[model samples]
Target: MSDDAQTPTPMPTPNDCDLPRRRSDFATFAEAIDYAARSEKGLNFHDMRGTLERVYPYSEMRADAMKAARQFAAMGIAKGDRVALVAETGAEFAALFCGCIYAGAWPVPLPLPTGFGGKEGYIEQLSVQLDSSDPKILIYPAEIAEMAGAAAERQGCEGQSWEDFSERPDPETDLPEADPQDICYLQYSSGSTRFPTGVAVTHEALLHNLYGHASGVNLGENDRVVSWLPWYHDMGLVGCFLSPIANQASVDYIRTEHFARRPLAWLDLISRNQGNTLSYSPTFGYDICARRISSQSNVAERLDLSRWRTAGNGADMIRPDVMQNFVNAFAGAGFRASAFTPSYGLAEATLAVTVMPPGEGIRVELVEEERLSGRPRDLSRPARYRAIVNCGRPLPGMEVEIRGEDDNPRGDHQIGKVWCRGKSVMHSYFRNEEATDDCLVANADGEVWLDTGDMGYMADGYLFIVGRAKDMIIINGKNHWPQDIEWAVEQLPGFNHGDIAAFSVETDNGEEAPAVLVHCRVSEPEERIKLRNQIADKVRGVTGMNCVVELVPPRSLPRTSSGKLSRAKAKKLYLSGEIQPLDLAA
Candidate 1:
């Protein structure tokens, strides 16, 4: 490449984004890379400003990975030895991840700093995850070398920069052979990270999920991707990056940090890129994008989402209202409402369990509020409906069902815990037998099922997730979902998603009561009191319970590495007084 081409640029190039799809199946990630290397298409990494930093095609990536694997081997990385990588959105991370596969080492992806907290906070998060993985070595980007070193030292690991690791001499060594049962990596999603559970995903588990992803998305023609999801997360690691590589389809990426700064650029890349793009994000991503574009003039003429065929929503509950607003805002730019594909999955099931059939879009079922609360629908009471989005059928080779408290399958339209069985189910949590046993169990059919720990109901083979089982709040012997309260508070003016966190807090009587921690920018005490009261009124109106509304400063509430609201952590912090409320009442 020319010197200018080697460096990143702000300009969008039409020629580099589209690459022909090659293979759709692989025995392992290594085999997929081996196959995809013959193709000209690969991943393009973007900078914090959404500028294209580097274009790494498959052939060159394979060469780099092979050499990196040799370096890893020279450094005494053996088969099944875990190599922890501080995953950033870049070529180095991609190369090291694949190099681990080639070296037969399990790559444990760790999160990068999102500035939610300062250096110490990031170090704590990194050290905790590193300790859980217990890797001998940690590889990290040079930019965060100091923080990575501190975290590595805490975990008794030797830390090295990605630049230093890449420059190591390549030893001409025989590659370690891996079997289908051999581990691919240790997947640590947000839920996993907060709880410190490392899901042991084998090669077989990963490939099965990818194949199902290909089949579920109908990946024969016009399947390209543009994503800002972080690689440490499953949807980003397996779905956007690995799935596209295995299928030999082209993908473009912006850093997760960058997406948080400029979410519109994520859509801008899609609008400017020349291909049928398939991208996935949580409801917040689309909401943020719409909010950004709404303020811009000439939005319709400037943005083009016509070719965005699969606009997927996952990693959290799908918000139909936010999606509808997005469609209404972007329809002038040819964005279709049918492009919304709401799906559900967790790290334990590898990645995708169910995907909406292509072109079927967001299908919602309006169930009565009484029936949802596990009570008979009384005609005497006025009917209130909760619109649960259909998350579609299970992928090929996957079985999904809703099971009651007795552990038996529930009938259609009955709300209960979600259970899924498939080849993609994780083998176990690495070295945590007790934890693994709690979730993975076998039935008379000899099929192992993963208890998703999510409450949902099935209708005509589609899954409708209500809320996380652990996150459900019980007040006065009635169950309430945190999302309902959070969404309710968001409906009030001056609030949106991420602005508030709703959970259960113990009262003076030691009974559970509703609590909401809201992010407030209002400085005057009167406005703050007014806002807090407004939030409490709305929440009480919806939940039928008095709520303690505490107005906190912006960015005070905690979030997962993937930017999902961490109600569990938020509650812990609040109860411990770590999250001090702004003095709105005063």
Candidate 2:
């Protein structure tokens, strides 16, 4: 018999009822990890079938991290040096990330190669980010050594596989201490593909946001996390991974790819857990699960979600229709509508600007299309409304304001640009002074504020998001949100969320018009033309004008690293002739 066969199956880390939990109140993240190591709670890795594979205790993780820190010191890693790491969901990545903190180097978490972007595309993305970060070394999993190495070489930076890097000498060396104001890490925004900018977060800012979010959720006894979110994204890395450690909570994690294959396995893991569960995802994750279960039977018999106390929704616009569908599909499985916690945040804010308080599900306000478009109501036309989801109030110590075009604060229920001010806001876009100056504005009082680039409004202290300011389609001085057009087309038969990309394009007549690119599945030419015309009419009704509608093949629309639809990239690709529309019968 093989030694592997004889070895006993590993057990997961305990919930650590004996240890007193801290809400990331520590001075630095290194200190947070150190305190967490004293407890039994740690991270647990799961397979695609929701089976536990490896048990990583915090004590063991800290020990490994120290060794990694020593190895880094031996390699002449200096304070504030950039160590680029491909954010993989595992203990190795977690340990190395902490080790960089211990060594006083800023750990930069980059994305792994996604399914949509081929090898060369991933390599190019990595190379661009590496050039922006100017890292001393790039470390990634051995499985993608060839691609990672190529990217690192292209940018003239040292690259080593995690396995190879770990095998190096770990000589005794003193690690540097971290300060609250010192740069902790660099996080590249998920949508930062064409032009990348690294957002530098300090140790203080990270801990502040973590503590605020933990307090906002009222993290207490029996509260644990179950997540399949990719660590490369801000929500996954800060809210799930780092926050769990600082708060001293055990976590169950499934790889994002695994969850993509079997989303129900996420619920399976939650069902098996005895404690109160907290899981978060974008609207699409819930949409995918609800759609996948439609063709199956006996869902309630197989899954249980009664213990899911916090079902967080963030990283994208919260869709009320999608949320209702999820509730309809899983309410029988003990999923409560009240557990849905919608939040609003960005990478620049270090993860969360505001998180819905517990017990408040998806709250929304019905705003007239005229108000949303920044135009007066036209009495001749019937009123059209859009449901804007309330994304909760600001976190403790965070301030939110909606500003008009004059850069003055707008009143309640007035749609304008969203701005946030807090200690949790990022220090700057690393090495990009021009970009930093463009977004981070200072008042006469010398208080700095972050322009979130999102358009929203305030009502009774709650925030209701309209859409992205950059995504607003302006035609003949009338502002129209692409979401409005996309959601209108989705109302038509045979369409899904993320199936359409809408933007403004200039026509041959020197007039700007709305252009809708839809993912069409029908192969017949006549049906394609019908679908195209149907979509065009739907868009026309929304915008009150004729628009360009093209049917593209399915699965061609570009998505950000975190799986959010990238309309900017879609428009660029369509204009560059990279995204070809299918031919229809004349």
Candidate 3:
């Protein structure tokens, strides 16, 4: 009592109001509606010009969403029912998502088909996800209505475009209130590289993450965000779309296609609109800075980014040099190093896991490669090391632990599997309890933690991601499962014996497709050149994707400290831009 009484309790203030209500139960659709209504600014989507289009005010969006909910209810989608949404980003996508929530149906947003080998490959993937999700209804955009309808027909599900069903009457019936533990949505990771797995997030989980991110990142009604990341991605959906709405902020959204074609438009939009908070593709967007630096004289003097607060880096591996280059290029443009927040997150954690706190600058640790790859090391000795950016500490109410292969907790700076458990943790994989159980493991203390499948360790209370145990490759901020690419190349004649290594390289442009370094054991230079072209053509044909192929002498590929081929190390070599290319006839 003497010691306790000596310490004074801190007084709660306005910032404390930003803190979330700590609870186990999830907020229902009704709660979301109420929150939107209570927000002073209301809800609307802005274009590149910052022209606010009243897609729906807080009340109208909710009412429209509820009406859509009634339509879904008529289709037998009740509370806990699964509904799939496959559409581009627009007012309809948001409305359908909210409608599913209001109907007590869980929404699973699928990636629009792209980069597939062909239409057949696209159809195959679409069928696989549709079968896996087994939703009651498939909602799609009018433009892609025929393809979606055919896919749904093949899967024995009803499909309709928004235009077809938007005018349907709102069944004026009150649905059952969703419990906090109720599953909100199934976020599918980009299956660019492997079969996409759906992460089942609960309503409570999303609310907690949204609250932590909004407050921690200092986002509020005053902040305006302009985003081009597709809604299919966790960063785009959570960080750009939902977070803004949750924080009572305004958001400006441009189509991903438009941004991809006109990268400069992103900056132009930001400058023109005076958007304060935003995100971008690290590789593709790095070009924006380079183009500005080379072409636009006195860019820094011309633009004002002083109002920008959080420039989050995630969805792909963060490149140290890229960040440095961007900072140097834009130094005169009012962009500060302190604003670069290197972050780590996955689909399983409702988008954000660890965010480097704002104003911390970029905290990175340079660890010797030998020690990081599991070689026995002397920690006390000073040695040359590779630098890895820190993803900061866990958010309030969340706990993180690094565990070894034996499942026991690992000590500081020891690489192992990253595991986490919190209010934002997902409930289960939709319908597949076996798969869910494999991911969500129970520890001795009976706490269920999600296995992130990412390899990383903790040091001095901060988390550092090394690589993935699943062999996933992130190119240009897009996740491409390595096995998928390998499968595409393995069909070629000369690519056997694992002669092909597909991994990501952090180029100045952003993370491009894994540089396909092939070890074609041919001696003749001419034959090797021909093989290289054949392999490249095969990869493109099978995956309908473009990748840089480098033919090196046989046995040139590097291996991990554990005798396995190291993609991370190979990527390092590729970035140096010294890998000799075989002169192949185009």
Top candidate (TM-score): 2
Local distance difference test values of all predictions, in order:
0.85, 0.91, 0.67
Model 3: CA > 4 A from native = 1-26, 40-56, 191-194, 273-275, 278-293, 376-384, 472-515, 518-586
lDDT by residue (1-95, candidate 2, tens digit) is: 87667667677777656878889999999999999999888999999998889999899999999999998899999999999999999989999
For residues 1-586, write the lDDT of model 3, one tens digit per residue: 7765654532211111233432212265357555654443333454544344444455556667777888887767788778888847777888788888878888888766553224664566567778988888888888777677878888888888888878766656777778878888887765211236677888788989887766556564346676777887787887776775566555566766666466555665566544465554543355345544666677866567676677777765565656787778777777788988877777778877887888885777876655555544545644535567788878776789999989889999998889988887777766777878888888788998988888789988899987677665644334454544554565676553345678765456664666688776777768877777787787665334677788776656654211235565566565665445555442
- Steric clashes per prediction: 0, 0, 9
Q: Tens-digit lDDT track for model 1 on 1-586?
A: 7665654453332333344554446677788888888766788887766677788987888888888889989988899999999888888888888999999999999988876678998999889888888887999999999999999998898999998887789979999888889999998867832267889999988989999888888776555789999899899998898888888787889988788887888988888777888999988899988888887667788889999989989998888999998997899989999998888898899899999999999989887776666655656647767889999889999999899999999998889999999899999988888888898989998888899899999888888988888888877778777887888788788877788888888889887889999999889999998888898899877777788889999989888866789999999999999899998656
The predicted structure with the larger lDDT, 2 or 3, is 2
CA error at residue 277 for candidate 1, angstroms: 0.7
C-alpha displacement of 279 in model 2, angstroms? 0.6
Query: Could you report the Cα RMSD, in angstroms, for every candidate shown?
Result: 2.6, 1.6, 13.2
Query: Scored by Cα lDDT, where does model 1 land?
Result: 0.85
